[model samples]
Target: MRQPVTLSSRGFARAMRADATKAETLLWQALRNRQLNGLKFKRQVPLDGYILDFVCFEAGLIIEVDGSQHADSQADVVRDRHFEEQGFHILRFWNDEVEKNPDAVCSAILQAAKGRG
Candidate 1:
């Protein structure tokens, strides 16, 4: 029998959250506990077959922190199209930027949330 979708997604999300990268951990601090404009963000959220780094449902915003490995990826273009079709705005930041300037990253997230709020 096939497992329920929610169970698999939740399990995967939990694993991803636990194994978060340094940049993900740094950014999560600012996003968690409603520190940014009282908006709640979920990490390692599974959506449409992709696991998003961070997502705020209220704002329909998805934040993706890309490492050097993501440079010029065509898969990203396809993924972006999927998100756009779903009416979610994606905000991407370099992993190094998230590590070095978390505050600025939070600020950008806040702005995006406000725009949708």
Candidate 2:
């Protein structure tokens, strides 16, 4: 079973959800409601001081919608390593990709979750 989230992390997650990006909002619409392969996904989930854009716990997957700020980001490298160390598989997509090609994004997500499913 997963550990309970700290109050601070929970609060931060809530804030992130409220302040979600356009790409995040777009992806969330498709990922929510089990619209993708009957898999459940959570948005703005907090983990180890980081808020993931979308996470499917059952699949041990983390989906990141990256904006311009994330281009060549060292912080992201570190963050990815940390999550990978904890057995989470991450899939990153550009903001424009999510907005312009949602179907492809969904397809990639579905492919990644295939192993888990």
Candidate 3:
């Protein structure tokens, strides 16, 4: 069974959307409005008590743009496992990777989405 989205979680997601990081903002521009192969993507979405960086429900894909703090994170491992168990494929990218090469990031995302579809 899926967990209910709590009010706090919704509020947190909203806040995250409002205070997006520089890398996130750039990626959002690339992914928003079905820009990438007409695939719809939502940012700062709340799912099963977690705030996802980007999600395409139709493709069952989740994209996470992480900072240096997420390096070797056990929490991320558990989170990725949970998402995988839920039948979602996750693609993680570093902030620098996104910032430096946005087109490459978008290409990767498109490739992943197509593979999932």
lDDT of each: 0.88, 0.93, 0.95
TM per prediction: 0.90, 0.92, 0.97
How badly does each model clash, as a count of residue pairs?
0, 0, 0
The best candidate in terms of lDDT: 3
**Candidate order, TM-score descending:** 3, 2, 1
Q: Which of candidates 2 and 3 is the stronger one according to lDDT?
A: 3
| Model 2: CA > 4 A from native | 1-4
- In Å, residue 69's CA in model 2 sits off its true spot by 0.7
| Clash number for candidate 1 | 0
TM-score of 3: 0.97
Estimate, for each residue in 1-117, the C-alpha lDDT of model 2 and write its tens digit. Answer: 355789999998999899999999999999999999999999998877788999999999999999899999999999999898888899999999999999999999999999885
What is the full ranking by lDDT, best candidate first?
Answer: 3, 2, 1
User: What lDDT, from 0 to 1, does candidate 1 have?
Assistant: 0.88
lDDT tens readout by residue for model 3, 1-117 = 689999999999999999999999999999999999989999999998889999999999999999999999999999999999999999999999999999999989988998676
Clashing pairs in 3: none
Best by TM-score: 3
Cα RMSD, each candidate = 3.2, 1.8, 0.7
